[model samples]
Target: MQKNHHFSYVIGAILILAPMLAQAETKDINQTKFSKQYAGWAATIEQTESEDMLATYPASVILWAGSTFSHQYNSPRGHKFAVADASHSLRTGVAIPPGGNGKSASCWTCKTPDAPRLIKEMGEEGFSGSNFVDLGPEIKSVIYCSDCHVDGTAKLALPRPHAQNAMAKIGLPFDEQNISMQGAQTCGQCHVTYYFQPENNNKVNMPWIFGNTADAIEKYYDTRRFYEWIHPISKTPMLKARHPDFEQWSRSKHADMNVTCITCHMPTVTDKNGNDYTDHKVSGALIHFDQVCAGCHKSKAQLTATLERNKAEVDAKSRQVQNLLVKAHYEAKAAWDGGATWPMMNEGIMGIRHAQWRWDFATASHGMYAHNPKEGLALLNKAIEQVSAARDVFKQVSSQVGAAKPVYPDISTKAKAQAAIGYDEPAAVKAKQAFIKEEIDKHWHPVATTGY
Candidate 1:
C-alpha cells in the first residue's frame, strides 16, 4: 500500500513539472545555436515568440514600445541638436545673478522638458514647492514630432499625460477616440500664451480663470496687477505680449465657425504621385498657400489677393491700436503723477489691460489676419476704438489735474531699451554661456537612445 501511494505522488509531481520543463527546453533549443541548418526553423520560432509576447501585452503598451523603438533607431537627431543648441545659446544672454529679480522657473515652461522632470526629481526640497523661479535655464525644445505622433503612424496624437490628467481634473471627459481627434488641444496647452504668478507658485497656470476671451484674460491681469515689466521712459507697468494662439483662435471665425489651428496649420496634402497625407511640417499657414488655402478656395489668385488686402488692413489697424495703447499709458502716467489714488486709477488701468489684451490676441495669432480677413480686420478696428477711447478719458482726467504731458518710451531699439529697464544684462549673458556649456557636455556622454 505504501509503495503504491509513493508511486502516485511521483507521477503527480512529474505531471506538474512537465509543462515547465517543456517551456525551458523550447527556450534553450531556440537560443542554443545559430546555424544555416536550423536557420528557417529558428526564424519561425523567433517570430512566434515575438508575436506571443506582443499578444500578451496591452495594445497601448505595445504601441508605445514600438514608437520608442522607432525614435531610437530611425528618427533624425538633427532637429533635436539644433533646437538644444539654439535654446542654450539664447539662454546664455539672459542670465541673472543668484536670487536676482525677474528669476523664476516659470520662464523655462515652454523651453525644455527637463524643467518638469528636474522639478519632480527634486520634489519638496528643490523649489520650496513654489520654486518655479529656480529652474534656471533648463527647458529648451519646442513641441516635436514625438510630442504628438506615434511611431510608424502618420496620425497626429496627444503625447503628454499631464494634459489629460489636467483635463480630467476639470471634469472634461475623454476616451481614446475623442482624445485622438483632439490632437490640437494637447499642443494648445503650451502653444497658448500664459503668465505665471508668484502667488500661484505650486500650480502650472494660465490666466484664464476669468475666461478664455480677450476681455476676460485682461480683467484677470488687471485684477491681479500683473505686469511683465515697467516701461523705463513712461514708467507705466507694461504687459508683454505672449503668443496667444488658442485664445486668438477661440475668437476667430474659424474657431467661431468650428475650425481649429490644426485645420489650417496641419492640413493634409497630396504628393505629385497622388498620395494624400496630412502635412506634419508645421509652420504659418501662408507658406503653403496653394495646398492649404486653394484646397478650400477654388481660385488661388483670388485667395492670394484677398490675403494681401487683409494684411494691409490688419497692419494699418494694428498700428492704430498700438499707438492708442501707447497714448493711454502716457495719459495714465500723467494722472498718477498728478496724485491720482488707487481708486482713481482703477478704470484707467482696466482700460489699458483690456486694450492690450485685445491687441496682443489679434497680433499674436500669426495667421489670423488671413484666415478670416474680414473678422481679423474688424477685431483690430474694435481694439483701436477701445484703446483710443481709454486714452481720451485719461487725457480728460489729466487736463482736470493740470498734469504735464507724460513722456512715452521708445522700444524700437531692443538693446538700448533693455539696458534702460535695469535688466541684469551681464548675469543673463553668463547664465546663457553656462547653459551652452552644459548642453555641449551632454553630447559627449553616451546618450541612451530609448525610453522617456
Candidate 2:
C-alpha cells in the first residue's frame, strides 16, 4: 500500500510538471522555428483539405475550443441565455424524442465525441441517429479547434460527419475546393434558421425547405400551415423562433461586402512590439470594435453611431410587431368566444403563427442588427407590415361581433404568465429544483462543516 501510494504521488507530480516543462521549452524556441512548424502544417492543410486528415483531430479538442471560443465571444455580455447560446451553438444539447416515450439519442450527432460510445453501450435499446427531438433544456458543450482547424495549426477545415456521409453517398467526393463554402458547408449545421416540430415530438429541425433567408423561411412557414403551439387565451396557433444568426447575418452588408464571422469575431491580435496573432477571443464585435470593425470602417465614431442607430431601429420595429401580434391574439380570442368554429380560427391562427415566427426570428438572432443594420431593419420592417395586414383582417372580423377589450396576460414574467395560463407552476418548479439538485449531487461532493 505504501509503495503504491508513493508511485501515485510521483505520477501526479510528473503530470503537474509536464505542461510547465513543455511551455518553457516552447518559449525558448525562436519565432522562426515556431513559424516554420505552424506555417508548414497550415500550408499542407490548405493544400490537401482532406476530410480524412481533418477527422483525425480528437473531437474533444473541437468541443473544448468551441466552448472556449463561445465563452470569449458570445457570452461575455451577461445576456439571459448566454450559456444556452454557447452550448446550443456548439451542438451539445441532448436530444429529446418529439412525443412518444421521450426517449432521445439521435440529437447527439455533431455535438459530442461520446455519442458513439453511448449509443454502443446502449446496444439494441439505443436510439438511431434520426430518432431524437432537440428539446433538451441545457446546451451541451461542443465545437473546438478541431471543428475548423488542424490541431496546433491555424488552417480552417470541416468536421461534420453527416455532410461527408451525404457527399460520399452521392458519389461526389468531399473535395478540398468545397471546404470553404461558409453557409451550408460550414455554419448551417448549427447557425442557420430552424424551427421545432412537435410532430417530431418538438424536435428542432432546420427549415431549409425554403432555403436560408428570412423571406424563404417565412414563405415555408406560410405554406406548411405549421405552428409551435396554440395560445391558450387567443386560440390562435403560434410559432416560436430560434436564433437565426447566420441567416440574418447573411443579409448584412458585411456578408455581401464579404466580411465573415471568422474575420471579426476571430480577429488577428497584435503584441505591444508588433507580433501578430489571431485573437481567438470570440464575443460581440462591440467589445473590440477598434480591432475588428475599425480595420474596415476607417472611422470609429461613424461606425459606432451606425451600430447604435441600427439597434434602436430594430428594437422599435420589434415592439411594433409585438403590438400587432397582441392585437391579433385578442381578436382571435373574441372570435372563439363568439362561437367561431375551426374554419373561422384558421386564418387568424395562420396570421398569429407567421407574425410570431417573424418576431422570434428577429429577436432571437443575437448581434444581428449591429452586424448588419440595414438588412436587419429591412426584415423587421417587412415583418411589421405583414403583422399590420394580419391585424387589419382580425379587426374586420371582430368588428361585426363587437369584441370585448382584450385581456392581454402578463407574459413579461414567465412564472406568473404560466400560472395564469393554467399550467402547473408549482409542480414544474419542484421538478426543476429536483433535477438541479440531482445534477449537483452527481457532479460534486457534500461539504463538511468545521464548526466547534
| CA RMSD of each candidate after superposition | 15.9, 11.4
Worst 10 residues of 2 by lDDT: 443-452
lDDT (tens digit, per residue) of candidate 1 on 1-452: 99999999999999999999998876533123322212322222222111221122222111112121111111112222322333333322333457654334444444444544555666423432433323433444333443454423445444433445433443442344353336556566566656545464533456666676566666777788877655432344555445556556655566565556666765666666886655544445656767656656778677778778877888777767766765676678788788666666666666665666666677656456665556556667777767777677677777877888887555443333333344454565676556446633353221111111
Compute each candidate's TM-score over C-alphas: 0.63, 0.66
Candidate 2, 167-269: lDDT as tens digits = 3433433454343343223543445455445464434456655465666766777688775545565665555455566666656777676666766665666
Best-matching candidate per TM-score: 2
Residue 448 displacement (Å), model 1: 18
* Candidate 1 residue-wise lDDT at 435: 46
**Top lDDT: which candidate number?**
1
Global Cα lDDT for candidate 2: 0.50
TM-score, predicted candidate 2 vs. hidden true structure? 0.66
User: Which lDDT values do the candidates have, in the order given?
Assistant: 0.51, 0.50
